[model samples]
Target: MEQRTHRSEVMLSESFMYDGVIIALIISVANNLYDLGVLDLANEFILILIIWYGIIEHFIRNSNVINFDIRYRLLFYTTLLGGAALNTIVYKTYGISYIPIIIAPMIITLLVDYEFGASAGLILSLSTAFHHHDFFMFLHLFPQVFISTYLLKNTKNRIQVAKAGLISGIVSLVMILLQEPVRHFYFSMRDYIVIFLNPIFSSIAVVGILPYIEITTRIYSNIGLAEIATINHPLLKTLSLHAPGTYQHSLRVAELAEHAAESIGANSVLVRACALYHDIGKIRNPEFFVENLKSPEENPHNTLPPDVSKNIIMKHVTDGIEIARKNRLPIQIELAIPQ
Candidate 1:
C-alpha cells in the first residue's frame, strides 16, 4: 500500500511539471511590458526565480508535505514571477509599482509556506531600501513582514488568522512609534489601520474558504485525529442504546489497540478505528450479549452443549462485518472488525 501511494505521487509529479511551467509563463507575461528598459531586466530575473523554486524545485525534488497540482503549480509559478514581471511593466509603462512591494509577499504566502513568505517579503522590502537608500524604513518593514507572516503560520481557521493579523497590527503601531519621525512617508495615523487590517482581511480570506478547499481536495489534513473521534460519534449513540454491552466492549478494545500501536510503531489510526467497531456484529443479536439483557434474560444456548454454544458466539464476528459494510464505514474501520 505504501508503495502504491508512492507511485501515485511520482506519477503526479511527472504529469504536472509541464502544466506548472505554462502557468508560470502566462502569469509572468501578463501585463508585463517588455518595452521598459531597466524594469524589464528585473522582471525576468524575478519570474525565473519563482519558476525555479515553486514549480521546478517541486518537480525535481518532491517535498515531504508541500505540493501543487501539476497544472495549478503552473499558475502559482507565474503569479509570483509574474508579479515581478508585472511590477517591471508598471514601472516601465506608467511608473506605478508595488511589484517588489505589496504583491510579492501575497504571492509568497499563497504558494509557499509562512516562513518562506516572510523571507521573500523581507528580501523585497530590503531591496527597496537599497534602491532608495533608506535603511530605517527598510529595517522597519523587514521585521514587521517577518513577524506578521510568522504569526500567521499553520493558521487553519479565519478567527485564528484574524487574531494573528490583529496582533500584527498592534505590533506595527509599536514599530511606527519607535521609528521616531511620526510624519515619515508611511501612513502616520492611517498606518495603524493598514497594519492591523492587512492581516485581518488576509487571515479572514483564508479562513473563510479553507473548509471548501478541504472538501474539494478530499484531503484529510487531519484525518487521523478526526477519524478516531468519529468511531465514538453519536451514530454510536444508537448502538449504545440498543447494544450497551457491545459499546463498552468496543471502547475497551479501542483502548487496548491504542496501546498495541505504541508498542509496534504501527498505524495508530487504523488500530483505533478497528477497535471502535470490532464488535458491530453484536448489533445483530443484542439479546445474546450480556450487557443488553434488561433482566437476566435466558441465554439462547442455555440448553445447548458447550461446543454448540461456542459456535453460536463465534458467528457474531461474521455477522458484525456485514453490518459494518452495510453502513458504508471506512475501509480501515470495516477491516478492523473481529475476524
Candidate 2:
C-alpha cells in the first residue's frame, strides 16, 4: 500500500513538471508576441493564452496518438509553441518575411510523428493568423502546412524529405499565385523570386536540421523507425552472437507482428522493430532458456521448484527493460520488452 502511494505521488510530481514546462512555453510565446507588437499588452495576450490552452485541451481530448506517449505530448507542444516563438522573433527582426511561417510545418513534422505534426501545423497556422490578425495569411499558409504533413508522412530518408519539400514548394507556389490573381497583380522579379524561393529554402533548411532533430528528440518519425530497424544495430548484433535461438525467435516474432499490424491498420514498422528487441534480456541467461539450450535433455528449470522457475522466467522482463534502457533504444521499442 505504501509503495502504491509512493508511485502515485511520483506520477503526480511528474505531471506537475510536465504542466509547468507547457505553461512556461505558453507564457514565453505570449510575452514575445506582445513585445513584438503582434499582440496588444492587456487583452490580447491573456486572450491568446486562453485560446492557446483551449486548442491544447481540445487536441488532448481528441488525439490518441499524442496522448498515448508522454514524449509525443511534450514534443508536440514544444515544437508547436517553439515554432510560434521563433516566428515572433524572426518577424520582429525582419519586417514581415514569411520564412518562419513557410518552414514551421516541415520542422514540426520532422520532429514529431505525422499525427502530431499535422495537428501542430494547423495549430501554428491559427496562432500565427491570430497574432497578426491577418486571416488571408492564414488562408494562404494553412493548406501548405497541412499538405506538408501528408508529404512527409511516409518519408524514409533525407532524399524523400527533400522530395516532400519539392512538392510543398510547388503546392505553396500555386496557392500563392491563385490567391493573388495574376490578371490583377503586378509581378516584380523580387516578388516572383520570393514566392518560388520560400518553400525551396524551407525544404533545404529542414533537410539541414533533420539529423540534429532526430538526435535531440529520439522520437523516430516512421522513416526514422525504419532506419533504426536494421539488423546491423549493435544490440541486435549482441543478441545474435550471445543468444542465437533468442535472435531467431525475435526475427520470427518480428515477421508475425509486422504482418498482424499491417492487417489491422497499425504501425507495422514500429511493431516489427519492437518485436525484434523484445527478448534482449535473454542474452544474459541464454543457456538457461529452453530455446537456447544445446541439449533438450539438459533442462535447467526442471531442477528448480515452480516458484523459483516462475521467478526466473519473469526476471527476463526486468532484465530486457534494463538492457533496452542502457542501449538508448526509443521508448516505443523499450516498452515492448516485457511482452
Candidate 3:
C-alpha cells in the first residue's frame, strides 16, 4: 500500500509537470502571436498563474463534488486553449466584437459546472481584454459570460442552449447601447447585426459541436444524460423487454431519486440516469430477483441454499458493473451501480 501510494504521488507530480509545460507553451505562443511587449507578456503570465491557482484551489476544495482527474484537467486546458486560439484568430481577422467569448464558458459550464465555467470566462475575458487593451470589450463580455453560464445551468435540451444564446445576445445588445453615447454615436445596420447576432451565432455553433465534444470526451452534459435516459436507449429497452418488473422498479427509483437529488441541489438528471440503469444487472437472471419474479412461487432463492442464493444476489453488483462498462456509460452512472 505504501508503494502504491508513493507511485500515485509520483504520477500526480508528473501530471502537474506536464500541465505546466503545456501552459508555458500556450503563453509563449499567444504572447508571440500578439507581439506583446515584455510588460504585457509578464502580465499575461501573471494572469495564467492566477487561473492556474484557481483551478488547483477549486479541485482541492471540491474534491468530493468532482473528480479532478487527468481527463478533467485535459478538458479544462483544451477548452481554454481552444477559446484562446479562436479568439485570436477572430479578433485579428474580423474584430473584437465578433469574437465568440462565450464559447469556452458555455462549453465548460455544460460539461462540468457553472463555477468552473465562470472561472474560465474570467481568464479568457481578462486575457483577451488585456491583450487588446480593450477594457470595454471585457466589460461587455464578462457579464455575458456570467449570464450565459447561469442560463445554461442544468440544461436538458438544445433549445435551452439556443435560448441562453439569444438572451446573451440581447444582453450584449444592451451593453453595446449603454456603452455608446446615444447623442453622438451613429451606428450602421451592419454594426447592429454584428453586435446583436454574435452571441446567437456563437451559441448555435456551440450547440452544433456539443454532441461531438460529449462523445469524444465521454464527459456528458445533462443533454446527453437526457438522451441516454430515454426509453429508446438500447439498454433501457432491453431491460424493459427482458425484465419488465425490474424496469418498472428502476423507473420508480429514478423518479424518487430525482426528486431527492433535486431537493438537495444535486445533479438530478445524472442521479435519475444512474437510477434507471442501476438494476440492469438483474436482467442476467431476472427471475432470481424478487422484483422481477412474477410470483412468490417463482422465487429462485427458495430452491437454492442460502450461501448459493446470497452469491447469486451479490453477483448482480459485479454484473451491473460489467454491463455498464460494456455499454460505455458515463463514469458516474457506472460508479453508482455498486453503490
Candidate 4:
C-alpha cells in the first residue's frame, strides 16, 4: 500500500509537470508564429494547439517515454521548444538552420534513447515543414535526424558520438547532392565547407556539453554508468568492506539480471544497476542477517522474538533508504533497494 501510494504521488507530480511543459510549448510556438505575422491568429493558433496536443499525447505519453525521470522530461521539452524557437528566428533572419534537425536530435538520442529521439526528430521535422511551408525541407531533414538518432543509440564515448554525427553528416550531404546534382558542379569551396561542417561542429558541441548536462540533470550517460559501476565508487567499496556477503550477493544478482535483461530485450543498464545496489541497506547491520552470519553462535536474530527479528530485518530497507539518500543515488537505484 505504501509503495502504491508513492507510485501514485510520483505519477501525479509527473503529470502536472507534463501539462506545464505542454503549455510552455504551446506558448513558445504561438509566440513565434505571432512574431512572424501569422494571419488568422485565432484559427491558426487553435489548430496548431490541437495538433500539438495530439502529437504529444500519442508520441510521448502513449509511447511510455513520459514515465522517465522528470529531469529527462524537462530536457525533452527544452530541446523541442528551444529548437523550434531557434529555427523560427533563423528562418526569419536568413533562410534555414540545421540546429533543430542535427544537433538537437543527436543530444536527444544520446541522453534519452533512440525511439524517443526518432519521434522527436519526426515531430520537429514536420513542425519545421509546417512553419516554413516547405514540405521538401521535411524530406531533406528527417532522414538525417533519424539516421543520427538510430546510429548513436549505442554510443558510449565522445568519439562514438562524433562518429555517429559524421555518418549522419555524410547522409545529409548525399541527400543535398541528390536534390540538385547540377548545382554542386558550380559550388565553391566555401559553400561545400558550410554545408559539410555543420554536422561535424554540431557533434563536437554535443559531446562537449554532455558532461555538463549529466551533472546538472543527474542523468547518467553510458559513460557515467561505467564510472559508477567500478569498485572505486565510495558506496560500493564500503559495502564490500562492511557487508561482504551482501556485496557478493549484489554482484551475482547483477550478473544474472544483466543476462536476463539482455535476453528479454529490457534495459540491461538499468536492471544491472538496480541489482548491484538493491541490498545496500544490509551494510548497516551485517551481523544481524543470516547471509552474513560468521557462525551459528554468532547469529543475533536467534536470540530475538519472532516480532523483533521481523522488525530488525525490515529495518534494513529503511536503512538502505537512508544510505541511498545520503549518497544521492539515482532514483531507480534507490527504488530498487526495497524490492
Which is the leading candidate under TM-score?
3
Local distance difference test values of all predictions, in order: 0.54, 0.69, 0.81, 0.70
Per-residue error for 265 in candidate 3, Å, reads 2.9
The candidate that achieves the highest lDDT relative to the unseen native structure:
3
Predicted structure 3: clash tally: 0
The candidate, 1 or 4, that scores higher on TM-score is: 4
Estimate TM-scores for all models. 0.46, 0.81, 0.86, 0.80
> Any runs in candidate 4 off by more than 4 Å, and if so which?
1-35, 40-55, 86-100, 154-159, 181-187
lDDT of 2 by residue, 1-339 (tens): 999989976785566456645654574465355454533433344554565455544555466656567877677666666667776676666533354564656766665556556656666666566566776666766777777777886566677767766676677667767867744456566766665566677778877776566666666666667877879998899999999999999999999999999899887988988989889899888877888888888878878899998888888889999987787777777777765
The sequence of per-residue lDDT tens digits that candidate 4 reaches over residues 178-218 is 76654334555664565566677878888888777766665
Question: What TM-score would candidate 1 get against the native?
Answer: 0.46
| Worst lDDT 10-window in candidate 3 | 60-69
- In candidate 2, clashing pairs total 0
Model 3 TM? 0.86
Rate residue 165 of model 2 by lDDT. Answer: 66
- TM-score of candidate 2 against the unseen true structure: 0.81
Candidate ranking (lDDT, best to worst) = 3, 4, 2, 1
* Candidate 3 per-residue lDDT over residues 1-339, each given as its tens digit: 999989986786676656655674585467347575777777777776667665644453455533544566678678878887888788888876688989988998898877878777887777788776778778888888889999998888999989989999999888878888843336677877897899999899989888888778777889988888877899999999889999999999999999999999988899999999998899898888888777899897988999999999999899999998788887667778888
